[model samples]
Target: MSYVKDSDGRWHTIFDQTKGSSCGPTCMRMVVKMMQNRDLGEEQARQLVERKNGVAVLSTLTSENGGVGQMGSHNWGNHGHHASGGGGVGVGAEPLAAALKGTGIKDAHVPQIYARQALLKTSLKNPGIAAVGWGGQWNGKRAQGAHWIVVAGQLSNGNILVFDPIYGIGEIDLSPAIPKYRPANHEATLYNKNVVLTAK
Candidate 1:
């Protein structure tokens, strides 16, 4: 994905790649950078990054369930394949919330809270939080590595400074709806062609 500034002075990220291997780290780094600028302590910022990554959480979830799937299930449903897990919708939120519950920031409810906020058209007057999704194709078919992104920030101009795990830090307008699913490898190209966000 490449970050570009449009003529309207808004920064947009284009996902030109077929997979999101680099996307997660890019997004995480962007959020870290943003947090650093916000005066969050180094330990706190590192913890936030760890929660955003969700590797440990995913591992714990998998270990508890003897692997996460029903019978004959190749794909791990919403949790996604273990190798490509942690990038699914809302994956980052629960962990982050758990991490920052006692803190006074009140920003722990990032993933789910932001998702519902966007869906409900609520004002993000407090610390901004966002969730990301992979809405496009992967390898010319559906289910070709679909994923989600989580971003958080106060709104500046008409756009929100975002930390999209599927893309990266940038500004996205408030009119778009978050995607419900991400395509797996070999099934992404035709996964969500021409799908429009009618709400939120």
Candidate 2:
């Protein structure tokens, strides 16, 4: 699914990467849309980030029981077969921030927001799009690995307005979203740092 229509009948872009690993770029594209109101497709965002950041952002990443990394080409129990779970692959905070800056977004910064209070405070302070790293479960199913999404803003009740590449626009509570955060990993942490692009 490449898009989902919101209640207002506006079509929001959902970067479906079932065939490839490009969540980082997809989230960046969503940020561009939320911040600058410009639409950049998945491929375009991938190319732009890699080109601008001068680094390769695509790779086969795997996760097992909330763990992320390359552990051979095989899963734990089945050491003879290929890895059958987790497919999140994308850029880290530094590269993502660099890519945004390369696109002329001056307000991009990666902040360490590990708690809901921090996230709320940061979201309130910065009034633009945020590329948030999401893990844990979605739709009653645990995610294979880490994923990236766009945080448009915080609602009055303190829920975040999220624009997921796979789930589209919705609101999620900060409770479940925060604990799954593996702050030790750069790609899985919230915000990857903060990116609040000013209006153009």
Candidate 3:
């Protein structure tokens, strides 16, 4: 499978990855969609990642046992969310990579990308897709933590293109996405760290 674009050269429709805090899963969904050139809708994408990552069973059973909004004494609950409460918990690299491995997608690599240079060299250069972790200010505004977005491509002028599940499709105009983010293993506060999902 290869990345496909519309007649106008834009990526396909953007889909939300989760009803709750499932940024990793959502970004994985974005990677899958772009790599396979398919529009796997939001609900299905959310379910697939959860199913593969073992969150589905836990969420489903919890929902069944406690009607979705039932948050227990231990503060654990179902991913089948409601406006009230009781929603999903997010996963990190291990589970995200495991899910990708289970799919057996050729040329797919779920590796921890620690440096921004490497991310640009590998991911954006190929006009490829990457599930990137970024934080701090984005588009000159404050952003959230442990979040994920799919990098679609980059331009010669240093405009990094992406498809965000929450913010929709846009550009990551910032090189490294965060200049101050010192490269680290698990840090998501800066764009320096990412559990990148890359495919040809």
Q: What is the C-alpha RMSD of each candidate to the true structure, in Å?
A: 9.8, 8.1, 8.4
- lDDT by residue (tens digit), candidate 2, 1-200: 45665444556565554323455677777666655778777667766666644432332232333221253211122111011234344444556666676666776766554445434543422433344444454445544454555555566655665565555566546666452333223224443334433322
Per-prediction TM-score: 0.40, 0.59, 0.57
Candidate 2 global CA lDDT score = 0.49
> How many clashing pairs in candidate 3?
0
In candidate 2, where is summed lDDT lowest over 10 consecutive residues? Answer: 73-82
The most accurate candidate by TM-score is 2
Q: Whose TM-score is higher: candidate 1's or candidate 2's?
A: 2
Lowest summed lDDT window (length 10), candidate 1:
188-197
Q: How big is the positional error of residue 149 in model 1, measured in Å on the Cα after superposition?
A: 3.4
Worst window of 10 by summed lDDT in candidate 3: 68-77
Give the C-alpha miss distance for residue 98 in model 3, angstroms: 2.3
